[model samples]
Target: MTAGPRRRGPARTVLVALPLAVFATVGVLAPILAPADPTANDLAASLLPPSAEHLLGTDQLGRDQLSRIIHGARISLAVTAAVLAISVTVGVVAGTTAGYAGGFVDRIVSRVIDMAVSLPGMLVALAVIGVRGPGVENLVIAMSLWAWAPYARIARARVTGLRASPHLDALRLLGAGPVRIICRHLLPPALAPCLVYASTDVGAIVLGVATLSFLGLGIPPPQAEWGQMLVEGRPHLASAWWLAYPPGLAITAVVFASNLLGERLAVGDERPSILRWVLPGRLRVRGGRALAARVTGVPATIATTSAGDGTLLRVRNLSVAYPRGSEHRRVVADVSYDVPRGKILAIVGESGSGKTTSALASFGLLDPSAVVTGSAMWEAGAAARQLVGLTPRERRQINGRRVGVVFQDSLAALNPLRSVGAHVDEAVRNAGNPGQRTAIRRVSEDLLHLAGLPDPATVTRQFPHQLSGGMRQRVQIAIAIAGEPELLVADEPTSALDVTVQARLLDLLARLRDELGMAMIIVSHDLAVVTRLADNVAVMYAGRIVESGPLDAVIGNPDHPYTRGLLDAVPRPGTVPGTRFRTMPGRTGAGPDDTTGCAFAPRCPDVVPECAHQQPRLLALTSLPAHRSACPRQQSDGPALAAETARDPDGV
Candidate 1:
């Protein structure tokens, strides 16, 4: 899937990483690499400048500056290694544990991490050294104490963000325990950022140790150190320049290497020079990323236009594909549905079924690699817009401003740095409100309250992390409705919340529809999750809608095997005790066009021989004009399908 790349990753590994490697190697073999004893003093050669014997000249006491610098590399690198090891280990463990075990423990640990970060790191090291006295052990401990907080903070943020992810949800569904989920799944991604941060941290530790040694608290005298050499060379800075320059250059080289290497690794690209990449923003990057984009500006009036017909959004044969190798692979194929005014349409499917892709692709919200096609006539109004081919500029006028979205992951959607008020206020401004500061703040609080947050004033001041899952989702709703959008698209908004919270959010959505007369398209993996929120439901399988109709019609008389399986999986009110959830017996990761015949034929219990040979088109059922099913076995009254079925019986 990642075959097409415009640029190769940063080649700075040659420039920076190799130098850092050489630094480590020199540190490891300092004794062998150094020509003379760094500590051996020669009165006869004292104060001699650079020559054949002493390459970097001699310090005031005639200690070979090159040897001292080489040995000093050993001390600095060792201290950095020790401190990094200790800090990374403690930080990752503490942060992972706290992030994994949330609520009070997470709050407590987060506060502790914050305090640790707030402390003067150098001062903390100094205090630790003051108590324990100067030595390698004390220096390592002091530096480690100073260093651990940043790693902890990084890990905690990473883990916290991932805690409610679908991957983790899937793990839990598979009966994986907490330890397995955290260690096997969570640790790898969390560690990537920490390791990258550690690359930059190498410089900080080396500099810290050098600073302490320069102040006489680190590596205590006679043993040659870079900082000690600098101190000795201080008086002769003007007369003999070689004394300070070599060690100074050595320190600069190590620091520069670490910083550049970290920058290269973190960005995951070769050109950290001019290009910037982020997951979602003004400029977004994803798999086989499109580096930048140009304007496809929307006509000004389309943002305020309304559909006169009952349908708010009428999508026909909508297809979305991403480049896979040389060809485009369809993730969503010929998918069609509608969101009627003041009604909720639910798109339900298993993970990778492309429910989210179909909804997001309609709005230009998918990764830039996605190539979308077909007509999405975004309103039945006279001034209707075709959303499929719209530029980002045009999509923006409709999406965030006219049609709001509440993402499945509210934590990911909301900025961790920005408070609730800031997010809402920004949305309000972006929605074209452009109100005064006090007026905007007031509107933001009102919107938060409208989204079902009781204490809007208190909630406004809190960050995304400070709020619970339900609160965060509510905040997302507030931000979404800042534009008073006619349409709302919520992608599994309540999936991460508890039953009570989920119920409350659903109620809020229903209430919003009744009050604002807004249409909504809600996407979900579990059919049961959105049953309460949706008026009409479309059950998607392998990127195709298997069945779609009114909530009761599809739920009660599910014609497609996949739809039946989804209905079976939902726990019933009068179910027998200890009954296991009935899951379909196949993976849900195939494309609609991957199989020539029925995509679900292999997994379908009712699969006939003909089902393996031909794909079935979604046709109107004999029972109802609005209801439709893709399974040929589900009798349809459509003339073309009926005649084809009667003539061939197998659609061969």
Candidate 2:
């Protein structure tokens, strides 16, 4: 179940802020509040307990207990702050570099981090201070040396995970520099938990300084510190317990507050799922109709699937082949399609149908081992260009700006560390927008709202992990559509959603297409989904399209046997619940070379002698000039035609 909205009120904020404020102030103002000189020699007034004049009573130093406690504050606060700073900075940098660079650098860094962690913090600090001679600087050096290793190790682990995240991949595809991507995407999440650690560590580091000082190995006593005071008060502990107790309590208070605040802050902000916020807002309604209009400029023919006719994107004879183990085979073969301005075209196929591969081919984002050959041309307004044969820089200039994609998995698509608003801002920035930071953030909030997220301002402040699956998907849509590109490629955009959520997402996409006038390519395994949003549908089987035409004509009377089989697969409620489902016979085989005959023949019940021996070209199936099919016997054989003509008699 989705989490309910977080209550926002002064009580919660105060509960979080009060302790932190108190601790911070005490730590920072310690030096000014000592009732007596912490370092003043008081050999005469030594060993006195609670008294009216002495208040908490005099210590072994004849000095006021309160004064000594206050003085100790300065030393502890400095040590803690210094250690935290050194550790966080060193850890984030080292880990980020190691994670992002990977390979040899990562191995070497990991080894170094492991080696460092083998030593305990106290031991390391003691060794460093022992050699350096105990002083403020030496003590700081000791604690920092001990502190940074753990931070580095954890940060390294987090970075390693982030390096492989899809958001990073998406950023790379958009031409983000290594530093920009790492700092923007990788570091934020890595550092948030670290922030909590760092906050808590301050108190511990301060205590370490006090410990060394107490042991005569920390800050030499001309400078008043809690440990020094404790050491000085040791001789009179029985009588002057006030001296030691006050300072001890002060340290406890600061540490406790910091710890509590750290834990609370660590919970982070709440972020709802983007799919909820974005998809429904953009597409859905109570009436279950696509009330939104198609995008301007797209041809009406394609708009029926989503609207506009500007030839926003075109792909010609695209092919992509991935290696099996070490052997080579083409996974996607000779695919072609066009995305008109402000229109929706759905690519329908089962798993391994090459729908995704085909999309990947258009952008030259195939795996290194997968050889890709294709020319994709795209135009928006006056911006006409060819995607194939373009250099990295050239592709960078166009990808996020001219073409945007909503991946199947929104969580995979978004950076877990970043807030929804930031991701949207990134898309806008990548598109070459000149807005200021404030404007960018505002636009992000607005986009989140448009995507259907509530409490836009608060939601904008949340990281991806805070959101639900649906909300995350909505944010992904927001980011993808943020740039307002001419072409939007949705690869199984709603595949992971439940029926209601899926319907809502479909409605949102249809609305956005009409409102923004953007052309869309919806890739899915379900033809029903295509029928909902596609003006034109292309049925793919074994990496090739077997049929193509208007959605209504194609669904009403599928010419290809494979296409008919797909339509029959959509489940219908209230049907005989336990009835066995009809399924296509054989799995999609390997590529063109894997089989000499039609790839579907093994599964095609009407397979003939000629089907196994000859390859068939996509041919016009009827007088409907736009309708086409790849089956060789489309013009002949009543048996196969009868099966193709058959519908779900049960209305399922």
Candidate 3:
């Protein structure tokens, strides 16, 4: 179920670059394109206006203005190219090294760049020309001397900001050398902003060259430069306007085009709606109501049935698609599962398997770009609420109050600036807890204590950064449970943590579940982690629930090949040292909409010819009524998934 056509780059970018491209082309082909020799003098043909032979007319020196302007473009392009080449290379290399090295090197480079930027660039060029004597080489060198500073500044800032990122640490752990890390990872990203800046610098460099030539400090006389032509035609403005205007207009077009191209590149996808006129529907969000109306593609009259007896949250035929260009691409499809009361249901899968996506979609936690469809029945007494299409106000009533979510990255999840107490206090207040400031703080500490944090009173006062990764995660859990939520949804809660921390967190979750009787949906990639707490396990592959049943039953005897592969990948208690982990044999990035048939067919060990041609249906096994497998070959006497859809006539 894909939507509109694939999107392309911004239309305004093309419009902006058109003039620049034309100028570049003229510069490159000036010799062939010019009608006559620009420097060849003929006083008889001089002062000629628009005519059959001379399109842009001639100068006072009898030089063809068109040819002169074209040749002038060649000169301007040369200067710009030289300056950018030298400036970008020098600036980026120096700045990247300084930022990566940091300390004294960073301070020295930063101070030097500041000094260069502070000086007037035009004045620096003029001074250089005065000292070194004027020429094309001198002009490029002068401009580049001052021009390199801004790029250095941009690159330095970009690289400095990335120094503390976790990915760099990951690279170090992977044994990547400094040279490999900097060249392969750091330089590319640092260069992007520098290049964008250079797009803008094109105009300045071209203008500077013309300015110098105008003052007789640029290209020598008789070189047919735009500024030289303008100065020569100054006395003949009323008589031969063609001489000045042609070059003047060319310079204006180049400057305008370069500046515009730079802005568009910097803005990227956030550019204004210039293309909406050309391509109707804009294909973005047509309207909030319009997009919302089409979200589920189901009639509003069709309501969800009550959840099963012991089910806290029952999701059926859940699907989520994100907007790809104008079209929608489905990630999760027909994912069905249940979270029984007071029990942990772990959704297990490799990366991109849509395990987290399906869980997030069930609670309306997916971003606005997501188009979700399905029936997620959240049981409340005798009645049930459909979580799929709930309005913001309605979802808010349930999500933060009834369901608490803990994301994997605690640093990202918690505001670094705020104290842990502030975070939990806000959550308590948001959950409609009415209390004085003191009472709120006390309750916040109590929530932290309940989450198993040590010395909640002291922990509450510390910021997220001051705490350990495990502590920060517990803080998130504290905030989540501050609302006294019935269902806790944790996405990769123990990922990237030490074994001790992971086990402790898992134990805490299990304790909370057993003591408080909390129904939980835990999303994890490791089946070993799931084994610790999960009563039921749903194995996802390519956005579909390939197999799901009681954790013991499914883990002991996996019905689907994908499920078997996942279980096999789990680290066993006693394996030979240095033995490679047994992993599934195919790429895992395909979505449900990528193919018509089973997405895992290329990787499936028991793949039959039919697996490539037909969409497999999830069927129950004759051995277990509660269990189901998407693979049709599995021994089972069960009804078709179509039957389940048929039962819910107008459902997901």
Which candidate wins on TM-score? 2
Shift of residue 48 alpha carbon in model 1, Å: 51
Each model's lDDT: 0.78, 0.71, 0.79
Which whole-number lDDT from 0 to 100 does residue 247 have in model 2? 70
Model 1 Cα RMSD, 1 decimal = 18.0
Worst 10 residues of 2 by lDDT: 283-292
RMSD list, candidates in order: 18.0, 8.9, 20.9
lDDT of 3 by residue, 315-399 (tens): 9889999898989999998888878777789999988889989998976676666899988999756898898888767877887
Native-vs-model 3 lDDT?
Answer: 0.79
Worst 10 residues of 1 by lDDT: 289-298
Candidate 1 residue lDDT tens string, 1-652: 4544433444445556877889789989998999999999888888899999989999888889889988988988988999998998899888988888899999999998999999999999899999999999999999888699898889888999988775466345324568977775566556668888988998888888889989999988898888778888889999999988988888888888999888877876432232223211231222221111112222233234343347888888888988999998898888888888878899999888889988877777777677989778876447778888786567667866778988888776765645688788778777776545666677777778878888888998788899999999999888887777888999988786888988898898887776666788999977766678888989888998888888888887878999888888878898889889888897764578775677888788898766766777776666765667888565423465575445533221
lDDT of 2 by residue, 351-375 (tens): 8888888876777665545677777
Candidate 1 ranges with C-alpha deviation above 4 Å: 1-309, 635-652
Ranking by TM-score: 2, 1, 3
Relative to the true structure, candidate 3 reaches a TM of: 0.53
